[model samples]
Target: MGKTTRYRFREYHVTAVADPMALPIFEAVCVTGEERNCAAASGELHAPEELTRWIAGHCAQTGHQSYEQTTRTIVRAEPGAWQ
Candidate 1:
């Protein structure tokens, strides 16, 4: 039997959220499989559009496929987080 190549993903948290005004302070939403080893509070808040573009650019540069699919997995403004 041959060894399996496990798919590893990394999560990068940006200073954003579903409802930034919900809490006393705006907290970032955690996105998985984007930036590599980025600190939770490393950068400023990025809107949904900006975030998706950022991911696509990163993936294209790194020769990673499925960036488009990953972009569709983000949460919407409404409830039921599965989109």
Candidate 2:
């Protein structure tokens, strides 16, 4: 059998929805797991609050309920920070 991988929910960003004028818009976020060579996975949720709920749901379904949220930091550093 092949090895299994686990991914943790990172962050979510509001994208679009069926109606552009809707109060709550759909969101898309990238999730990364233990598989180093694997690419990031994306999931969509109807609302902002639903994003976190969906992530927890997925973790429970995948037998990874112990996945806890690590440090979450948003960077606004200068462009040269990448150097």
Candidate 3:
């Protein structure tokens, strides 16, 4: 008979790390009406303050009063020591 074989598996921990090379993107969309959605507004990698200002402006101009915000962030995951 052939010799018995053995295998081992290692466990790893995962966490999110920010990418220094890329900035987070911020977007906002007006959700004031039920029938249609307004064109999305983006900060294009700008800070949250900038996006908030844009949303406020949009709300004032269109009387939207309601909006949905989205933030896209670039992250990296590194494997930790085997456990």
TM-score of each: 0.28, 0.31, 0.74
lDDT of 3 by residue, 1-83 (tens): 99998998878888889899988888887777778877655546468898889888888888877778888889999767778
Runs with alpha carbons beyond 4 Å of true place in candidate 1 = 1-42, 65-83
* Ranking according to TM-score, highest score first: 3, 2, 1
Residue-level lDDT of model 2, residues 4-49, one tens digit each, is 9999765544433334343443343334456632222224444557
Cα misplacement distance, residue 20 of candidate 2 (Å): 8.1
Arrange candidates, best lDDT first: 3, 2, 1
Q: Candidate 2: where is the Cα deviation over 4 Å?
A: 1-32, 37-42, 63-83
Summarize candidate 1's per-residue lDDT along 9-82 as a digit string, tens digits: 76544433344443222223223345553222213333555555555665565544432222122333442332
